[model samples]
Target: MLTIKGKLGIEDFYRIIFKEEAILINKDVLTTVENSFNFLSQFSQNKIIYGVNTGFGPMAQYKINDSDRIQLQYNLIRSHASGTGNLIPEQYVKAAMLARLNTLSLGHSGVHISVIELMTSLINKNITPVIFEHGGVGASGDLVQLAHIALVLIGEGEVFYKGERRPTEEVFKLENLKPITITLREGLALINGTSVMTGIGLINTINTRKLLDWMICCSSAINEIVQAYDDHLSLELNQSKKHKGQQQIAKSMRHHLKDSTLTRKREHHLYNGNNEVTIFEEKVQEYYSLRCVPQILGPVLDTLNNVEKILIEEVNSANDNPIVDVEKEHVYHGGNFHGDYVSLEMDKLKLIVTKMSMLAERQLNYLLNPNLNNILPPFVNLGTLGLNFGMQGVQFTATSTTAENQMLSNPMYVHSIPNNNDNQDIVSMGTNAANITKKVIENTFEVLAIETITIVQAIEYLKVQDKISSKTKKMYDDIRNLVPPISDKDVPMYPYVNKVKNFILNFEEEIYACKELN
Candidate 1:
């Protein structure tokens, strides 16, 4: 079980959320939470506290009686639980729940200790709330999406337990779980935060790392397949430019292609007097997609590094309003719930991921088109050229998916529709940005999968499976084990495409490790 301490990070998130490690609350963290709750309870006596005695947002003008204060929280949970669209998957929802748990554990939301304990129970029990993809303007926090999470905390809404959507009450009984009772401001604190967007953004950041690692491997393998010169990925060439992303990508590519017998040295071929002919037969340089991988993907890596840093900090932040300050002895109300940090970062994330997908698509094109490589058969077809269309149909899937990513990459951070009587006049559509970025990331994985299959096909056509580096050769074997090479007949490629996509999505074991770029 992972213990909740002062700060949480991406690796902690991975172990708890993905590895099913139960969480243990720290004594000091819970003490701070209890102190904050007690202080808020005494401080709000006959005092005007937003979301406690007053209505929320535009409705904050009206005051609530002491008796109806409890009901007001319930009302907020039930009324705002109106989320439309598809349910967010279990993993991402759990991530949001963990993010919320960490923030509340910070002892600033004026939430009871039971709130943290109950959230921990729900997480450990794998009882994910039924959250939707649509709701969440990003500013004033993910109100609609988090409202559903809040509803589950009160035992009134449904939860996904044991792979089935069951009523929270039923699952609570089955697991001997008890719902958190509303006291002062549990409802307001639960939903008025950026955990939903931050959680999803954190997960997206993790997946981007994996996708980039595989992308470098694929880029290096393609170079070996084409027998391209090694100088493009050489240390001297990449380090000449000081961008960390470019140097890291080039360094990684060099590691991946180091043992490759097919990759030629430029100094050996061109620098020497071997270039006796006026017009050299061999193509002097590869296409930008092949040669400029370090430059193309370098910025992507650098941007991703920054994105990860921001997301981790956001996850560990008290991103809710009415922050309870034990030292200051005050309940400070402000816009900490604003999601601009996550929104802008997610927008930048999708943009870079789109560029990465474009690079993969171009590399796939170069391998399939014989005119580009001047070596491989049309479409890398090992079977009958005309009848058996090799990788021809799946290419459409990759291309269209990449185009959709280009469209989805448009900034959701900028598109804000003012709702709630314009009380949230300038909103950060952060949750929308996160959800769309998730789509872009998932779409890029599909493109990479198609690119992987195409690269392996190119390897087989050249009969250089044994000639490539151990890193890419193992990668080739991993893919070939899943989907065998195309034979003389044109089989359905959709199923194979999906298999490869899912493979890379969870393929974590790297063939070799490189220096940490960051």
Candidate 2:
């Protein structure tokens, strides 16, 4: 079980949502939450508290009567539950809920302890609220999307229970769960935060790191298959530049390529005769895809590291507006709800991932073309060259996918538009950026899948299976276990490609378990 004590780390977030760990609020944190609520109760009925006594947004000037205050909070949730487009995945909804619960547990949101318990109960019971992909300007804290989730808490919206969608009220009654009563500032506290964006960003960062590792591993395998020189990844060259990512990538490549008979020094490939010197060698160096793997992918690793740090801080932050301070007995209104930090980091991640895709595509091109490939058959066709169109069409698919990723890489942070009746003018499009980054990740995975398949095929054609590194050999055999090696006949490659893509998606955990890779 995972305990939420007003703070959540990125790795713990993944384990809670993906690993299905139960959650509990710390006792001390629960005390803080009750104290804040008690303090807020001391405020006068006529006090003009934002989202409590007064209306929200542009309507903040209008005050509600004491009898209608609770009703006002209920109406706010129902009205703001206006999310559109496709529903967010259950994993993301659970993550967002956990994030919101952690923020509210800080005792700054003025939410009742029951609200926190109910949210934890929903997660522990695997009940996920239906949140939409669209609807959120990323300002005023993912209002519509989170409001849809808030509606489920009050037994008024939809939820996915036991892998089936059901009405929230029906599930609550069946599960013996009671609907939460909205108190002063409870509804606002639920919706006024950056949980949605931060949740998506956190998961995306984790997946991106996995993809980077696979890319480096595949690049090393391709380097051996192409018989590229290993000097480019030498530690001396990398240490001279003094970039941490560059040095780390070079070290990882060397480790992956360790004890390989296929990799050769430049001198080993050169011929030195007793007579007049007549040099005989393949190219002096390799193309940028093989030669500059560390240089191109190093910066991407750096960018992802920086993005993960920012997201961790965002997840643990008190981003709610009108922060309740029980210690000072004051309510502070601030703009911590804005998602600019997450938006900008996601934009940067998108751009770097596109670059990674480009590098993968270039390596695929090198393996497909007969002239570029080290005397390999055209399109890696092992059978009759003209009849078998081995990987020709698949290479085209990779190119198109990489092109799509390039277009999606355009920065989304620069394209903010004024919204919310001009009252929320200059909105942050953080959610939009995060959603597109996910698409980019999906596309890049397919691209890497194509490269993985092609690299294995190239190795088969060269008959260098025994000469490759042990790590590369293990990776090759693992892939061939799932996807049979291409024989002397043509076969549809989509199934094989998809199998490899799924394999890559889960490969990170496998690596973590392997003592050799560690």
lDDT of 2 by residue, 437-503 (tens): 9889989999999988888888888899999988888888888887776767788899988999988
Find the 10 residues in a row with the least total lDDT in model 1: 509-518
Question: Least accurate stretch of 10 residues (summed lDDT) in model 2?
Answer: 509-518
In model 1, the runs with Cα more than 4 Å from the true position are: 274-276, 511-517
Give Cα-based local distance difference scores for all models: 0.90, 0.85
Candidate 2 residue runs with Cα over 4 Å from true position: 44-46, 270-281, 508-518
In model 2, residue pairs whose N, Cα or C atoms come closer than 3 Å (at least 3 residues apart or on different chains), thus clashing, are none
TM-score of every candidate: 0.98, 0.96
lDDT by residue for model 1 over 1-518, one digit each (tens)?
89999589888998997788999999999998999899999999989999889999999999999989999999999998989999999899999999999999988888878899999988988889998998889788999999999999998789998889889899989988888979999998999999999999989998888888888888888888888998888888888999988988888888877788999988888888864589888999988998998999899999999999999999999999888898999888899999999999999999999998999999999988888899899888989988899988889999999999999999988898898999999999999999999999999999999999988888888888889899988988999999888858889998998899999888767534253655
